[model samples]
Structure formats: structure tokens, C-alpha cells
Target: MSETTAEKIPVTVLTGYLGAGKTTLLNRILSENHGKKYAVIVNEFGEIGIDNDLIIGADEEVFEMNNGCICCTVRGDLVRILDGLMKRKGKFDAIIVETTGLADPAPVAQTFFVDEDVQNNARLDAVVTVADAKWLSDRLKDAPEAKNQIAFADVIVLNKTDLVTPPELAEVEGRIRAINPYAKLHRTQRCQVALSDVLERGAFDLDRILELEPEFLAADEHDHDHEHCHDENCTHEHHHHDHDHHHDHDHGHGHGMKHYHDEDMQSLSLHSDKPLDPNKFMPWLQQLVATEGQKILRSKGILAFSGDDDRYVFQGVHMMLEGDHQRAWKEGEPRQSRLVFIGRELPEQTIRDGFERCIAA
Candidate 1:
């Protein structure tokens, strides 16, 4: 069966800093009234294990890079476990991987994109981070893993809000927005957010981008320098041309938002009214991911293919990319491409110019 026809199971990664109430949240999710069955993968059978029938213990293999990031080295184990789960199909509707507090989310998220078997069998639903409302701010400043978790999240549950005053809560939220403005934020006492907010969120699905950001395809209305070219091998010339487009960096978190200056983490947007030539776009995109995958946390785009009415949508975590043609352009809808990159110190200029080179002449 083709990828389009496959039964892609949705996998949600649950992560947080140590003592951030991830286990509490897991217990709630398992004991809820929701009728769906879920296979829970955890670092271990906790002191008080969750009362789920399909609980699996992970090996907690962590890989450390030269840059001091600790990523999960459990791809092989995950592949084996998921393959086994497939044998018991109809026994569960979804799978949840609850990472160790110190685990980096990139590798976990990347597994769904990089592995052929995993990709064929499952789709990443979302990276849901359950943050300790009282300690998140400190963790953001002290822990790279904590920062990465926030940066990579599609939905953030700010747990233990009752422990902090309103002023402290606002401050913590500001800090989170500074690091990641795109993730949906929910305040809770014991990870009590509605299941609908976290499950089946289609974070990596291109067809759902518009629903998440209604102004996703609008023309660029802001004036800013869009010049980009950094690769030593990049021969593409930069040109200043006004296009019907806008790049959004502000995510509606108004004044008094703390200006966080994490040199390794930030988000950027690129937009163009010109349709892209697949011949130019594909190879360039592959090369981009191949060389810069380590630094890229999450990447997503919706493109207008040259001479085609169908919209092309793609998203990736690290080097893994998944995309396909969605529906055709609606009558009177603008045919444009919008791309968003959330990661650590992305080469904004080079990416912007490279994408410009893919424009159909």
C-alpha cells in the first residue's frame, strides 16, 4: 500500500524536565474516560507505575554529542517495539512515548521521519511538553534539554500553576513565548488540560497548517530586508523584489514579554508569492536537511508548485522530511508558499535565499 493509503498510527511524545509532573499527566491520560486505547512507552516502570495494560519499559539509552546535547539512542528499540505492537493491531488506537526528563525530543521526533518502518506505520501527532510552572523559568535558563523541549513542543501544558502567584505565572509564560511563540499554552494544576488539546493535533500534517495559522497564506505586508546567502557553495544572487507576502515573528504575546536571548534557539519564517519548481526545490531541500539537520528542531512548509493547482505540504524534524500534495487551490485563493523554521540559530539568510532560488522563473 502507498503511504497515502497506509494506516499511519499517531504517536505523541510526552516530555518535561525532572519533577515536572510528566508521570502525573501520564496517569491522568491513562485513567481518563476517553475510550481510545493507547500503548504507553516509558523510561521505566515508575515507583508507582501507570495502570495500563500495554505499558512498555524503554532502555533509557541516551547519546551525548560534542555540543552537550543528550539525545535518545533508542531508535532500534523503538523500531522493534513498534513492530511488535503492529502485530497486535486493533488492540490500541494510539501510542505515547514518555521520555526521560533529560531526553532530547529531536531524536524521538526524528524517528517518525527518518525510519522507513516507523514512517510507514506511524505519524507523529505532537510533541507535548508538560512544564513545571514554578520551575520552568529556571529550567529554561539552566538546562539545554529543557529549552529544547520547549522549542520543539506543539502543545505546552504549564503544570503546577497553583504553586506560583499570578505575577510569577505571567513571567514564566513570557519566557516560554520568548523561546517558542508558536506552541499552544495551557495552564493546569496537575496536568489537567483537555485531551482534545493534546491528542490528534496534526502538528506535522501540512493539510492542517491553515487551521493552526489562519493567516498562513496571506501576502507579505511588512517591510524588512529578506537578503539571504551564507553557503560557500551558494552561487544564487540575492535580489530585492517586493512580493505579496508577510513573515510573522510575533505570536500575539503582547508588551512586557521578556526578551530571551538564547543564541542557540529561535524561530524564523520565509514567504514567497512565486510558485516553486519541484526540480529546483527538492534537491535544495534535501541538501539543506542533510547538512543542517542537527540544528533544525522543527521545519514545515506549504508550497504552490509551478504549473500545478495542487498545494505541496511538507514538514520535518532534523533530517527527516515528509510531504505530499494536498487538495487543489480553492477558487480565488492565492497561490503562494509559506515556510516556518523553529530551531537553534538557523541560517536565516541562507535558507531565505535558497528558497528564493527555487522560485519558478
Candidate 2:
């Protein structure tokens, strides 16, 4: 990557279900004096009603197909809007895209990966989802978009905790973890959180995973006491612990133990000690994504390819995948491969078997 592309503008996608405090979070982001200029792209102008120097209203005309997929239609409009933003180069340091309450984040996210121009000018920093603490459990059951928003999040702000008790907050958090174990969760009232927690997160950057979540590949941390309370009047029977994974990043945040289970949307993590045959792995991965794109919301991997000195890093949103040879393996560092997939009803065994077959002899 050239220095020009290396310094590509970071784009943050903000999404949530209806009445989930998205606008409140947007206002907070805009109002914060972080000494950075942001070019905001919002679904509707009047809805947010916020004054900013570089705010653009999106038409939100992208329609979903019969299968309820929105990526096909929104790609063109997003490309056009993003291209226009590139013209005003020095006006902003980063971009924030706020989707509608009912929007499916797949198409919005796919835009950053699928388009050549957009890819050159921008990189997806993270998908920050603001979810209503009191209503999220119900929304998860009644609204598919709600599930998608939570599943796609790199940072989830469970807002409006004042509306619910501590036990209820724990329940909502549990539901969220069941869907996406990888996302960093924050409990807040009125969408209030430290600005450092959400911006420049490097969520989509494959190399930054170690920096973001140091325990991502650690095996001992895998045994989390997963539990959840589905009933409204339920007691706090779930096991909770304070587990802090320190990062070199400035934001000092600790993650709590998370546990929950949802049949529709879930996350799968895979690891391999052996180097993989790229030729075999690539073809198998392509076929898997092609056949199960809709079910596969987000896929990321850092692989030890056979006969390669550099680490092979790849990530995908839906069917679109992008990868490259990242930094070289350090001397004596373990060269195991790690992969995590967050989506709906993934065929875990089939994927594991295919990945195992890709192991080099």
C-alpha cells in the first residue's frame, strides 16, 4: 500500500434498531471536541437535526431484493457519495456513515470492500452499533435488522441503561454476546462513552486484531461461563467476572465475562497449528463464501500459509473478501492460524472440515 492509500480516510458505520439511540450517539460524536474533523453521511437530514460543518444527507433509496438483501442496490449510491467526498480531501480527517433504523448493514459494509475507488480512498474503521438496553431483547426476536446490527458491530454501546435495572442490563449484554462474541461491549446511559473507545478502532484491519484484543487467540480464555436470563423477572444467576485484556492502545477498557446463546445469529472461532496450502484454502474459501454469503456476515483470519514467511491476513463482509501478505513472522513466534466468523446459522462442522483439509501435508 502506497503512503497515500496507507493514510486512507477511516470510515465508521453507525447502525442500530429503531429507537436505539443512534441519533444521540451521533450527536455525541459530533459534539465532542476530539480535534478531528468528520464528514458525516446520514440516512435522513431532518431526523438527526444536528448542525455540523460537513454533514451530507443520504437518500436511503437502496432497496432490498426479494430475499431481503440490500447490498445489491446501495453499492452504487455509496460509491458515488464516497467519490464525491474524496474531492474535498483536506476538509475532513475521517468519515462516519449513520444508516437508517431499519437498514441492513451488510450492503453499507460491503461498499468499502467491493468498490475499487472506495477501497483506495477509504477503509472501514469499525461498525459501532448503539442498541437500546431495555428493548434489545425483544427486538432481537422480532426484528432481523436488529440482530444484523448487533452481529455486525465491532463496538456495541448498550445505551439507555437507566431505563432498565442492573439485571436487565446484564441480560441484554448476554444476548448481544451470544450473537457476537468478538465485539467490544460498553454499557452506557444516554449513549455516553469515551470518544476514544469508538474512533479509529481498526476493526477491519487484520493486523490490528492482536492490538485490539490481545486474548483473541489465547486458548485458556476460551472457557467463558456462558449464561443468560430470558425471563423479565429472572434473577442474576449468570456467572460474571472481570477479565481485562490489556492493549497498547490509549483507550484503557476492560472486558467483562460474556455468555449467551442464539440459534439464528452466532460466532465461530477456528484455529490450526499446521500451515495451510494456499491453493487449496483459497478455492475452498471462495466456494464457501459463494454458497453461504448471506449467512456469513463477517469473516476474518490470520493464516500461516505453507512455505510463506509473511503472515497471510484476510477478512470478508458477506461474500466480498480482501486479503494480503502482512508483516513477517517474528523469530520463534508461534505460526498458528486463527479465524473467527460471526453470522447466522453457520455450518460450523462443514467449515471446520474444509479448513482442516486445507492443511499442508
Candidate 3:
């Protein structure tokens, strides 16, 4: 089954806040001589490639661009548009969904994993986020969707380098790094990044994540900046510690940069040197997400089971989880398990206690 992946088309999700150069980067992709065919799905008409064009389907808002790429407006639902595109699949090499600037990427990404028909025909390649370096800092403070976009990104294009000073640029990058250190970061002007960097990144593919390792931020001792959101998902009756206070635990960053701690949204990383009992671990994880998935925006694990030679990996979006045995552990490699959860007001103690119980006795 090594060649099983080739049968599906790769879908790259483009996301960011308003005026983040998503359209510019997208136009670059459409105009570049990559010698590949693309079927683009935009949220509304006249947002992308609206120049002297041909109307292939008026009611459907599907048309052909001057560059020979097929473009369509997302009139009603995304699944319907994808279903229509699937019929003409062979004509294109890949699918790129440029979500509206105000859109949340979770539902868009969830389509590839939750729908069996979409899953069979397409595989998620990556979530590419275009950020306006000049204003990302401000958005990070005001917008929940902005933070989620940064946390969920696999590739981040920090564009408009020409707009700010060196100090301003570093602060913006630091803010982005605080949320997600794993995404590939590229600083560009006018969204002039190499095409190879964004397309076909395979960020969600199991093979691409073969060695799943993450860098984490720890609780900082000095910062005082904090903000909280009383999300309904965070207000659960957990039989544990005080849930009334803000969960603002800031991690120290470089150069005396103020560590901006998001009270409502944050990431937690758990690790175990000891092998986990699969019977116990699997059920605990499923139950954890089943009850808390609405709060959990994303979850992933690279596990080393107690009695198995092969490693297991899983990726989740809300309530959906997909996992499989990846490959045998190398002779000299350390056998350990690492799990990460990024979400809003997660039940840390419940998750920690449950994870601790999964360790093999």
C-alpha cells in the first residue's frame, strides 16, 4: 500500500484574515508557468480572476480564466462545488480552495476527513495561511478567528515585508511563533514566495509527518498581559479545580518580547517516556475528544505502544480522528509518545490525569 496515496488529488486550503494578500498569492499561482492545471473555488464572485473571462456556467458561477484555469464561485455549500468539480477531475492536476478572509478553516479542512466520498477522491495537502506582517499583531489581539488561523496553519506566508521596520517584523514573527512554531515561515514582499514552498507541501499526509516532533512554549514567569473569553465550551462542569479564573499561562520568548498569552485559546503538549497501553490510551483519547472536541480545534499524536514495534500516528479535526500504524521503530531511536492539543479552554487536569493513567504499568 506504499503507492496508495497517488490515487487521490491533493487539496490545499488557503486561509488568512482580511487584506492578508491571499488574493495576491493566489493570482501568482494562477499566472505562474508551473505547467499544472488547477480548479479554484472562491467564496464569492469577482473576488478572484474576474478579468476579461469566459462564462462556462452562469448559474453555477463556474468559468474559465484567461490563464486556462477553471474557476468557480462557492454559491451555496462547499461540498456541492466539490461534487461538481469531481466530475471534471481528470482535467485538473490539483484543487485549491481559497476560503473567504472571514471564514474559519476548520469546516473547510474537515470536509476532506469527515466526508467519505471527498476523502476517497481527495487528500488534504496543507493549510497555507497568508498573513499581513504589518497588521497580524493587531489581529492576533482582536480576532479569535485570526488566532485559530495561525494555530491551524501548516505553512505561513508573512507577507508585505516592505511595510514595516526590522523591529516591527521581529515582533510579528515572534507573535506567530508563540502560537505555532511548526509552520514553515517565509517573509516576502507582495506575496512573492517561491511556488514550490506553498503548493504540494503534503503537510497533512502521514508520510510527510513521518517524524512527528514539536517545539513547545513553557509557562513564563514575568509577563502580565492577559485576555479572556468566556466561551460556552469552556464552562463545563469538570469535577476538578477552579474553572472560574483565567487560564493565562504565558511562555517566555526571545529579546524581552512581551509574551502575549491568550486566555481563551492556547496549546498543550504532553509527552510520556514510558510506552502506552493501547487499550487504555485509545479509549481515553476517544472519550476525551468526544466530550471536549468542540473546544479542541486540533489534536495529533505520535505514539509508541507498549507491546508493538510499529509506531502509530493520528490527526484530528474537532470530533473526527484518523490514525494508522506508520512503520516499525528504528533500533536506536527512543520509544516515546507525544501528543498536542490546540483549542479553547481545554480541561488540562482531566486530560493530564487520563493520559497519565494510560502509561503501561
Better of 1 and 2 by TM-score: 2
1 or 2, which is superior by lDDT?
Answer: 2
How well does each candidate superpose onto the true structure, as a TM-score? 0.82, 0.84, 0.79
lDDT of 2 at 266: 80
Q: Which lDDT tens digits does candidate 2 get at residues 83-159?
A: 99999998899999998898888888877766778988998999999999999999999999999999899888889
Error of 2 at 329 (Å): 1.1
The positional error of residue 273 in candidate 3, measured at the CA in angstroms, is 1.5
Checking candidate 1 for backbone clashes, the offending pairs are 219-245, 220-244, 220-245, 220-246, 228-349
Please write out the lDDT profile of model 3 over residues 1-361, one tens digit for every residue. Answer: 1334446888888899999999899888888889987777766567567442221222222222233212211223556666777787678888888877777777777767656677778888889999999999999999888888988887889999899987688678767755664567788999999988899887777764653242221221213212122333321222111112333332222334444456667666677779999999999998887788778877878899999999898888777688999899999997878787877788888898899999999
**Candidate 3 off by > 4 Å:** 1-6, 50-76, 211-256
For candidate 2, the per-residue lDDT at 272 reads: 77
Local accuracy of candidate 1 as per-residue lDDT tens digits, 196-263: 98899988777797666532222212121111222222212111111101111323223233344456
TM-score, structure 3 vs. true? 0.79
- Model 2 lowest lDDT segment of ten: 234-243
